[model samples]
Target: MTSPFASKLRTNYCPSDEEVAEIKALLVEPCLRLKGLDDKITALQKALDKLTQERDSLEAYVQAHTALISPSRRLPLDIIQEIFVACLPTHRNCVMDAREAPVLLGRLCSSWRAVSLSTPRLWASLHVVDVGRLAPVHDSSSRRLEERAALIPEVTRTWLGRSGQCPLSVSLYTFPFPSDPVAPTILETLIQVAPRWQHIQFTIPAAFLDTQFQLAAKDVPILKSIALHQYDPFQVPNLAWDRLEVLRGSNVTGVAISGCDLVLPRLPLRWTELTALSTLGSRDSPVSGERHISSQEAMELISKCPQLRTLSVLFEEHGLFAETEAHPIVHPLLQTFHCRGNVSTFTFLPGCLSLPELKEFTFLVHLPGSDAYMDDENGRPLVRFLAASSHLESLHIGISQFSSSFLQEILRSFPPTLQRLRINAMSKIMWGARLGSSLDDAILSVITPGLGDAAPCPCPALKELQIDRCTAISDSALLQFISARAATLKRIQVDFAREVELDIRPSLQPFIETGLDICITHVRPTRKVSAWEGLPHAERPLLD
Candidate 1:
C-alpha cells in the first residue's frame, strides 16, 4: 500500500512548479498595491503643504491691510486719565489695595506710566490702615512712619501741581501703639498739608497723645469734616477748627478741654462756627448717675448748634437720668432727631415744641419702675413735641415699657400731620387694674377714636400702618379698625405669635380678599420670637 501511495504522490507533486510560481506572483501583487498607496500619500502631502503656504500668505496680507487702515496711536491723555479715575474705589476703607493699579498702568508703556504718575487725584487719596501690611519688615517702624507721613504731602503736591487747585479728599487712619512716638510727627505733617485737605478721618489710638501733644492740637483750616476716635482733646489745647462743618467724636475717654467741659461746647455759641456735631457714647458707659450727660448740659449743647439740622445720641442705659423737666430748647433749624436707648420719660423743651422744619423723629423709650406715669405725666411732652411739628411726615416710637392707658394717651397726643406711623414692641398692660381685659380691645378703643369716623380715618394723612407682635391684641379688632379706615390705608403687615389667632372679621375679609398688601408672619414653631418680628413692617414704626 505504501508503494502505491508514493507513486501517486510523486505524480501529483510533479505539477507543483507551476503552482509555486503562481503563489509567488500573488505575493508580489500585494507589494505592488502597497507601493501605489505610498505614491498617492506623497502626492497628497505635497498638495497640502502648497495649500498651507498659500493660506499663510493670504492671512499675512489681510493682517497687513487691516493694520494700515486701523488707528495705531494710544488713547487720548484725557480719556486715559478719566478711565484711571473711574477705577479708583469710592468707599472709605481703612486700607486701600491700590499698589497694583499704579504699577500696572506704568508697565503698559513709558507714556502710560507718565500719564498715571502725572494724575495726582489717582494717588492723592492715600489710605493707610495697616502700615506694616503696605510696607516690608526690613523698614523700621520709624522709617514706615516717615514714609507714611511723606505720602500725603507728596501726593498733595503732585495733585495741586497737575490739576491746579482741584478739590482733594484725604483720609488717614493709624493704630499707633504708645511705644510708637512717630504718629504725632506724622499727624503734624498731615496738618501742614491740610490747606488742600477736604476730608480727614483719624482713628489714632489714645497712646499717640503721650508721645506728641500736636497730634490732637493742629488746626485744620480747610477741613470740612473730621472724624476722630479714641482721642483726647485735652492733649491738644489750641485746636481751633475754623472751617470744620462736621465733627464726630467716638470713644473719647478721660481727656478734657479747658474751655469746653464734659458737655460739648454749643456750636454757634461756644465754638460759634460749628454746624453739625456728633458725640457717640460707648455701650460700656453708665446710663444712670453723674456719668450721664446732665439734662442742663444736653440743653446747652443743643442751643449752641444754631444751624444744627440733625442730631443722634446713643445712651448706654435706657434712662440717663430721672428728670421730669422738659429738654432744653432744641435748634430751630433742626430737621431730624434720633434718640436710641431706654429713655422712658422725656420732655421736649419749650423751644423744641415748635420746630417748623422738623420732619422726622425717632424715640426708643424704656420705662423704669412699676408705677410708670400715664396721661400727661409719662410721655405726653414728647407727643406734644411731635404734634407741634407741622411738617412732621414720619414718626417711629419704640415703647419697651408702658401701660395701655399710657399708650392710648400717647396715640391721642400724636399730631394729625403724621403721614406714616410705626409701633414697635411694647407691653400690652401695666399700671392699675386693666390686666385681665383684652389688650386688643383696650388698644383699639384708644386708637379707634384717633382713626377718625368710619367714613374717613382720623389721621387723614396716614397712608401706611404696620402692627407686629402685640400678643394681647385680637387681630380681628385690629383688622376691623383698619378696614373701616381702609380708604387711606395702602399697606398692612400683621406678624403674630403662634399661640395667637388672628380672629379675622367679616369687615376685614374684603381687605384680605381683595389682596390688600396684607402679610401674616407667623413665628416659627421651634424658634424664639424676635423683637424685630414684633415691629410693624411699615414706613413709620411705632412702639406698641
Candidate 2:
C-alpha cells in the first residue's frame, strides 16, 4: 500500500512529533492483524504437538507387542539351544567368562538361561585356571584366597553337573604351584568325574600327582586323549593305555620328570594303540632338560606305533647307520611325521623307516654346526625317503648351513602329488663365520614350470608355497615361479632377510585380481658397514 512517507521510510530522516504520531496510528492496524495471526499459529502448534505425542505413544505400544512375538522368543527350545551351542568357542574348551557363552547365553534372559543350563553339550567342556599361591596373600588377601579356593570346586561341580551324561573335555592348570590348597580340591572333583572324560589336559606340578591325584584303569574307561605336563613320566597316572588314542608329552615345568625329562622309551604309553603323538614342547622356545630321542630310539618308536598316523618328535644328532640301514621298518597307516634335530635326523629318514601312506612330512635341522649340511650327501637320504612316499602331499623343510646343491636335490625329489611346500633357510652362523643361504633364484627356477606342454615340474599340483629367509631369491625368479604355477597356486608367502629393492606388486596384480593370495615380506635395510672398511693406508690392515 502506498503511503505519504514512503520516500522517508528507507532514508535517514528523523520525523517530527506530529509525523511520528501519524506513523504510530498507521502501524496499529497491522500490529493487531499480526497479533491475531500469532494466536492462530500457537493454536495450530499445540494441535500438531498433541498429534505427534499420540503417534509416538501408539508406535511404541505396537513395537512393545511386536517384540513379544520376536523370532528369537518364538524359536523352538531345541533350536535355541543349538544357537547357544554355536556361540561356544570351537578352538578351546569353554572358560568361566561371562563375556562369552555359555555363561553369556545365561545372562541374556530367563528363557535363554534355562536353555543354556539344560543343554548338556554347552557344559561338556571347560578350561579352568586355578590362581593358587600366585594370588597375593597377606591378612585380608589370605581370607580372599581361601574363599576363592573354596568357591572353585563348587563352581566346577555345578558346571559339570549340567553335563548330564555327555563326555567331558577338561583342561586344568594350577599356575606352576603345588602347595596351593585349591588345586587338590579341584583335582579331587575332576577325579570324581573321570568316567565321562573323553579328553583331559593338566599343567600342574609333581606334588599334585603324589597323594591327591588318583585314577584307576577302570575309572577312565571312556578317556580317549590325555596330555600330561610338568609331572615325571614315572609318576604319571597309570591309565587305560590300550584304549587311549592320542598322547602328548609337554615340557618340564617344575622339575625333570626323570633324569632326562621325557625319554621316549620310558613313557608307559601303549604306542601301538596311539594315533597322534607330540613331544616337542613349545617349538618356539623349547624347554631345557627336554631330551631328544636318538635315531635308533626314533626308529624303535616308529616300529612300535603301528597305528600311529601323526608323530612329532625331536631326535639327537649322533646315531650309527649300521643298526637300521639294512632293514627299514615299513608302516602301512602312518601318514604325517614331523622330526626336529641336527643333521643326523635327516640322515635317519632314509636309513630307518618307510611311510608308504605318508601324506605330510616336516624335517627341521636346528643349530647345524660348520660340518653339518655342508654338502648334498645328507640330503640324498631325504630324496630316497620322498621317492618311497608316493602319496606325499605336504613337505616342510627348515634348516641352516645348507648348500645350494643340497637344497636343489631335495627340491627335485618333491613328488608331483605334493600340494603344500614350505622351506625355511634360517640365518646361518657358526663360530665366527656367517654362512650363505642355499635358497636362491636357481632353486626357485627348478620348481617354476616350463612353457612347454610336455615339460615336467616339481609339485605341479602345488597350491601353497612358503619360503622364509631366502634373501637370495630375486623378484624375477619369484614372479616366474608364481606365473608358471598360477593355475593351481592359491597362496604364496615369501620372506627375505634383506630388504626388497624392487616392487613386485605390479607383476603380481593380474594374479591377485584372479583371487590369488600373495604375501611377500622383507626386512628393512640398515645403514651398516663392514668392520674393516679402511685398510692400512689403503693397503693391508694391522689386524688379521
Candidate 3:
C-alpha cells in the first residue's frame, strides 16, 4: 500500500508561540476586511427597505385606481336582481314616500332604477292608508282633498301597471268623513283591476258600498282574500257578480267582514268553502238603533261553514252558540282561533264550539271591576279548551290584569308541547292594585318546577316568552328564573318593566353569553285604563 503522498506526510506536529504569532498576524488582515463588508451590508439593507416602501406605495395606488372600475360594477344582471330583491323592505305598514324601501332602491342610479322598475313584486304591494294624507303636488288647503282624489287614479294605475301580471294586494282606504264626496273616477280605476286581485283590504266610508256602487268581482277568477273593516255600522250591500266561475274550486277562501251589517244573505261569495273568516263589531260596536245577531244566527253561520280553519272575531254578546249546544260545532282542521271582547264573550263556549285540532289560542278580554277571572268562571272556556288541545304550541294572552294564582293555574294546564307564550298585561283601573309581583313570582315557581313532589316544569318545551305592560315582575325573580332555565329558554321579551331595566341585565349577562336572547324595556305606565276598561254597558270605550 504505497500511497502517492506518503513521502510528504508529517507526524506529531504542535504550534510554537512564535509560529502562532505569525498565524494571528495573517488573520488580523482578514478580520479588518470583515468590518468593511458588514458596513456594505448595512448600506444595501437600507436601500432594499426604501425600494420596498416605493413598491408598496405604487401597488396601493394601482389598487385604488383599479377599484374605480371594480368587478362589482361588472356583476351579472341576475345577481344584481337578487340584491335588489334583498333590499325590499321587511315591514307591513303601508305608505308611499320617496325615502322608503323599493322606491328608495330605484332612485339610487340608472341601472338600479331599471332593475327595480322591472321587479313586479316590489310594486305589487301598495298601501294607501288615507286618501287625504297621500302627499299631492298641489298645496292649496281648501282644494287639497279634491286634488289628492283626482291624482289617485293616475298614481294607482301606474303602480298597478308596474306590477305587470302579478296578483295584487291592495289596501285602499277612503276618507271617513269626506268634506266633499270622492269622485267616481277613483273607484272606477280600482274596479278595473278586479280580475287580478288576490288580496284586498279596505277601510272605506259606508257610502262607498252604497247600492249605486258596483264591483266586477265576476272577472276576479283568482280573488282569494278580502277584508273589509268598518267603524260605523252600515248594511253591506247585496254584492253581486254577473257570473262567477273558476277553473277549480272557489278561489276566494278568506273573508273578513267587520260589522254585523254583513248578514249572511248579503254576502256575495261562497261561505261553505271558506278556510278563514273574521268578523268584528258583531255586537261589540253597535250604533243606538241597529245591532243584530242572536245566538241562533251566529250558530247557523258556523254550522254551514264546516271547512273554516282559522277564526278571529270580537263578539259583544255571550252565548252565540248556545242554541247549537246539543250538536257541537267541531272544526276538525281549525288550528288558530283568536277572540277578543269583554269577559262575557267566551262564557258559553265550552258547551258549543269544539276545535280538536287547534294549536294556537289567543284571548284578549276586559276585566270587570267586581269580577274574578277564576271565581267568576270567565276563563272556564279557555282553560277547558286548552286542556283539550294536546298539540297546542302557542298562547297569546292580553288581559286587564294578570292575577298570580290565575296565571299559575293556566300555565299548569297549558299543553305539554307549548313552545311560545306571550303575556300582555294591560291596565284596567288597578283592578285592585295587582297582588304586586305575585303574578311574576307565581310564574317563576311554575317554570322553575320545584322539588320531588311538584308537577313537571310548566311549558317544559317553551323556548320563547313575551311579557308586555303591567308591573308584575321585579328584577330579582326574573334573573333567578332565567338563570335556572338558561339552558333551554332561548328568548325572552319583557317590555315596560322598571325594576328589570334597573338591575336584571348584569345578572343576565352570563346567560346571554351562552346564547340567551333577552330583552327588558323600561317604560312609565300611562293611565289609559279609563279608555280601555269601560264596562260593556258603559259609554262605548274608545281605545287610547
Name the best candidate (by TM-score): 2
lDDT against true structure, model 1: 0.53
Q: How many residue pairs clash per model?
A: 14, 1, 0
Write candidate 2's Cα lDDT for 244-332 as tens digits.
22222221111112213455555556556778777755322222124577777777777887788888777776654554455878888
- Candidate 3, residues 262-356: lDDT per residue as tens digits? 55455665778888877653232234112234334556767778888887765455433344334666778888887765544555554566778
Q: C-alpha displacement of 84 in model 3, angstroms?
A: 2.5
In candidate 3, how many Å is residue 267 off? 1.8
The residue-level lDDT of candidate 3 at 73 comes to 84
| RMSD values, in order shown | 16.8, 11.4, 16.2
C-alpha lDDT of candidate 3 relative to the true structure: 0.65
Order the candidate numbers by TM-score, best to worst: 2, 3, 1
Q: Which ten residues in a row have the lowest lDDT in candidate 3?
A: 240-249
